[model samples]
Target: MSETATVFNQQLAARSAGGSTDAPPPVRHVCVVGGGTAGWMTALMLATTAYGPRLKVTVLESPQVGIIGVGEGSTPWLRGFFDGLGIEESEWMPACNATYKSGITFEGWSTKPGFQRYFHPFASMLDNMTMHQFVDNVHARLEGADVHAHPDRFFVAAALARQGRGPRARPNFPFDIWYGYHFDATLLGQFLAAKALERGVQHLQRHVTQVQLNEQGDIAHLQLDGGEPLAADFFVDCTGFASLLIGKALQTPFVSYAENLFNDAAIAMPTPLGGPIESQTVSTALRHGWAWKIPLSNRHGNGYVYSSAHCSADEAETELRRHLGLLDADVPARHLKMRVGRMENQWSRNCVAVGLSQGFIEPLEATALLFVQRTAAALVEALEQGDLGPAAQQRFNDSMRTRFENTRDYIVAHYKTNSRTDTDYWRANAENMRLSESLQGVLMTWLSRKPLAAGLKAGRFGGGYPIVSWYALLAGMGIFPDPRELQPPTSHQARHRLDAVDDFVARSATNFPDHRELLAAIPPRVGDKTLQLYLW
Candidate 1:
């Protein structure tokens, strides 16, 4: 046998004999490479979980490497992460220039242009009703009843967003709305790092010069520049696109989603808050791709994601500036190249890749941080399941793969269903973009019927976007079947439901505080106990 294979066998034999090894060391220490939003988030979650006291987590970050701080929009699941970490909104919102995000508003995606718009609200699309009720409402609309209104009108969150209002402070109406945040990513990373440190996570400022692998091809140690080699039982690659530990050292293969999702680059910049902070993220479809306008407390995070194959960087930047009415403004636009795919295995051997290191599928839906958060949460679950063996690794990889592909399919659906053919980019995306088999099935199913909760109960990931999200996108893009196809409801029932929704929207708009006013009302700082009680 070869020397390496023989050594590996000898080590296994010694481990089996328990001469110097015991229970495979129990994953006592974890080393994280490259600290950013992903790095700090992983460290903080792992260091604060039930297993925190048993594991020692250390972060190796270099000051030279800069961060891409343009990921400001987030989904509602972020609130769960914050609450689980015992972090109150008042603690991080001010520090990160955050503003409440009710949901995303899509504009000009249909062929009939005149700035057509729709909202994908964070609230459940349907009230406490069954699919039969939804089908009846659609049929009633077909029978000359004025039961038709935009889907957002039924959601209190969307209604508040329309009125430039934030959440209400009603004691009895706690579950009436849902919200997330738009915050500076760099500031969020710094905030999470401080929390992790306070929870006993070690922070190191050093660059990883080389990664050393064991005989069995697992990460054994990481060599730092002008320092000793750092050893750990497990490693997390938060090294962004470089993917030092998982991609380079562990040799995990990457699977590209370029064919299904075409936008591969973005030019981002922050502008001064031009108006009152809007409670929703505005994603306007542009000629080449789309532009995101995320309103924060102090500034607007703006970016144009476009296909590099269709438009040159100069042209894209010009179009973005023109759209923003900053034709001659001297703001610097930072260009970013996106790798539109995920690694074949997020957890290979003893290394787990997080955030941009694992994969990226553009920022169309603000999915980068969601992926990071899910991966970190999955890692904790895997670690808690005894030793980090092959079974745990396989399960983690499968779960992460499901999350990434599910997100990719959702983003691809946006381009595939868009009816705008004004530009070559849109035409190509609508005609030539490849669809995954799963998404193809979904589209086919929706053509015959509306998406039902039972139809989407088996989503690959645990906490993925729900069926309501699919309904919003499909109905908003004008892809649903004729209302005549569904079962009909009595005229009295249809009128009652429609009037109820209108009444709810009117009351919500009247009661909620203006977006800016609510933000200003929040105390600059509050103790944890007070903030918890206030939010809870």
Candidate 2:
């Protein structure tokens, strides 16, 4: 078993022996309030045999509340979640109008004129010699070489994405390319709800009118709209921003990231695919905030996330339409107000909050679904480790806080390193914004040298993005140290490596099929059987 699992098991054994004799019994009955991605994902995760031998999972969803449904992009970790559930990509991909995502393409984030683009590919940098290649590029840059000419060319997935292609059926690639999905969020909720119900998770379509607290201040029972009061040993609050159970009832304090992340609202709309669909999420920096374009198999999910302090909703929508070249086209748009923060304690007493109820950063990197997956997995691990006592709850809270803060730092790095000075928003984010102490320190260190993997480790559950991710964002935004800080590579070796990179790019462009063609070639699954589709 992995070290993390071993440690968790050890903690569980210790807790079961003598820790907190007065603590509540091992959580067997779990009531998840609110049914969308968060609720169903939590229910289904707990319903697994790994967690469900003595556990009963139920989901209480309100018929009156509508789903926010704007989250369309996801990180590659989602693929592991599906695999754990024994769910085939063919089973959910078509059902969700899903398309493979190589990674995100960031545009116009630099101060350079015209459009400057960079790729944050999903492929694991650990397996690939990314850092070594970065070192070579740094040496080249010091020698006045045009090393910035397609920095992402070394990444196979990024190269595929640039050519409007997906992963190819090749055996001898340098590294395995990782990919996620772009799908309809509403359909995803329906798909997960179906899976959860199939796995014996009871679903109640009723509004929660009241929350009853125990003597110790933990949630005891919930009063439904027209049914008997529902009670459980533990509760999960998936009620989105309402945070009915964790926020309103538990009164968990919130820590806002607004000081670093200025965007507070988003206007989302779906537009018909005017042409061939792209194989990645495209985030274009706009005048005020930014616009995201996620291309699903059916339609393109587009949104403008902007600072309410800098621009009005109407103005943001206009800018979005203008950027999408849809100013003359009439498409319905939904305006969403977001609270850019996380709860002080995601796990408090007997209740835990997942998804938006726990917190929300702007959807800059599609982290919402990832947090839901991580939180659900963490809760299951805690439950496996005997009773959810103070020790376990504290650990869970600390781990989640680390994850949120780390993610916040990564997202902030995008705006913090941006050189755009055209608008007030850009100026504030680039020059005047206050960064988290940790981020500031990292930035300071990077000024002297490139970020090293050993130096960037967030021990255990500190929950930062991978070291390569930081490299991509920093190098893409031209945030590097003086090239003279490093020793120059031998002239012969540099030329050979540069030639090899060029050869690889040429071969990759020819080997991969067009993104649209690849999608068209996948045979449709029949009935409900799990088809053996080539996993991305």
Q: Estimate each model's TM-score.
A: 0.87, 0.88
Candidate 2: where is the Cα deviation over 4 Å? 1-25, 51-53, 113-115, 124-131, 139-150, 168-175, 458-463, 480-496, 508-511, 521-536
lDDT tens per residue, model 1, 1-536 = 11222333343355456543333336789988888899998998767544445689999898878877779988766766775555778788889988998889998887532226778877532243322344445334434344453456556666777888875434434334556789999899899899889989999998788899889888888888886799998899999998888888888899999887888899997888976678999999998899999999988999999999999999999999999999999999999998889999998888889999999988878888878877887776566556578887887788888888788888888888888878888998889537777787777766645434445676522125565577667666756334355344455746456566677667656766788887876633122211111110
Each candidate's lDDT (Cα)?
Answer: 0.75, 0.77
- Give lDDT tens digits, candidate 2, residues 396-422: 999999889989988998998898889
Q: How far is candidate 1 from the true structure (C-alpha RMSD, Å)?
A: 8.4
Find the 10 residues in a row with the least total lDDT in model 2: 527-536
Off by over 4 Å in 1: 1-25, 113-115, 124-126, 129-149, 458-463, 480-497, 523-536
Clashes of each: 0, 0
Model 2 TM-score on a 0 to 1 scale: 0.88
| Most accurate candidate by TM-score | 2
